[model samples]
Target: MEMNLVIVGLVFVVLGYLVGVKKFTWLLAGYNEKRVKDKNKLALLVGGTFALLGIGIAISGFAGIQQAETIMFVAIGIILLELVYVNVKMVE
Candidate 1:
């Protein structure tokens, strides 16, 4: 359990960087533009969200195994939604 949390934390640390620095200001710049854009904003949002999830998972993982499942589901659900959206867009 402890190991899982450590892994999650590391992943989130990378994600937080991606959202907060790498693709960050670009996301905001997207809102300022006039043309339609498939901005990286969603990536930043999702990454940041998962980063928090990782934090929560790290906290809960310390408690018990069952706690990790909840965090896993939430993260998986978010990814699934994004996948579905992407697939539907592709079909169009």
Candidate 2:
């Protein structure tokens, strides 16, 4: 089992919970309060992504998947797409 990935995944889950449920928008880097059109939407989108990604990572780690690099790449791609979507649609 990949302990490191599990640990990282747990951290992401915690962060996602804080941001999505606790409304800790400040945890997001490069986030601007004034520029964002809908704070709740931003929180939901980003936090949901993080939570899902974390779950996937944790599961993959526990399953001892040999293609962890592929998972990481997919995660990165998802994040990049999310960044673009947020910047283009959510930001003012």
Candidate 3:
């Protein structure tokens, strides 16, 4: 579990680079294909949020905290919702 969380963290960091720095719009899963009005802002907010969530989950897992898995899954679910919002709402 700890290793898995760490792996997810690393993936999020990579996603931050791809979505935030590289401006990769298609990386997100939503069907909304609208162009973003402010790519940099969206990138910074989503990328940073994901990065922090990933790190927090990893740390919790490493500590063997009870219910950490549940928390992590819930957080990931929330992130997915955010991704949809970014697609459908944040874009032009």
lDDT of 3 at 21: 69
Taking every candidate in turn, the Cα RMSD to the unseen true structure, in Å, is 6.3, 1.0, 2.8
Best by lDDT: 2
Of candidates 3 and 2, the better by lDDT: 2
**For model 3, what is the alpha-carbon lDDT of residue 45?**
72
Off by over 4 Å in 1: 24-40, 65-67, 83-92
Q: What is the C-alpha lDDT profile of model 1 across 7-91, one tens digit per residue? A: 7766765666676457653433223333324446555555676567667666766655655556678877875785565445432
Ranking 1 against 3 by TM-score, winner: 3
* Candidate 2 deviant stretches above 4 angstroms: none
Better of 1 and 2 by TM-score: 2
lDDT of each: 0.59, 0.89, 0.71
5-53 per-residue lDDT for model 2 (tens digits): 7887788789889888888999999988999999999999998989999
Clashes of 3: 0
Worst 10 residues of 1 by lDDT: 27-36
- Candidate 1 vs candidate 3, lDDT winner: 3
Q: Write the per-residue lDDT of candidate 3 for residues 18-85, one digit (tens) a residue.
A: 77667674676652445677766787777777667777776776776668568777887978888777
Using lDDT, rank the candidates from best to worst: 2, 3, 1
Q: What's the C-alpha lDDT at position 27 in model 3? A: 78
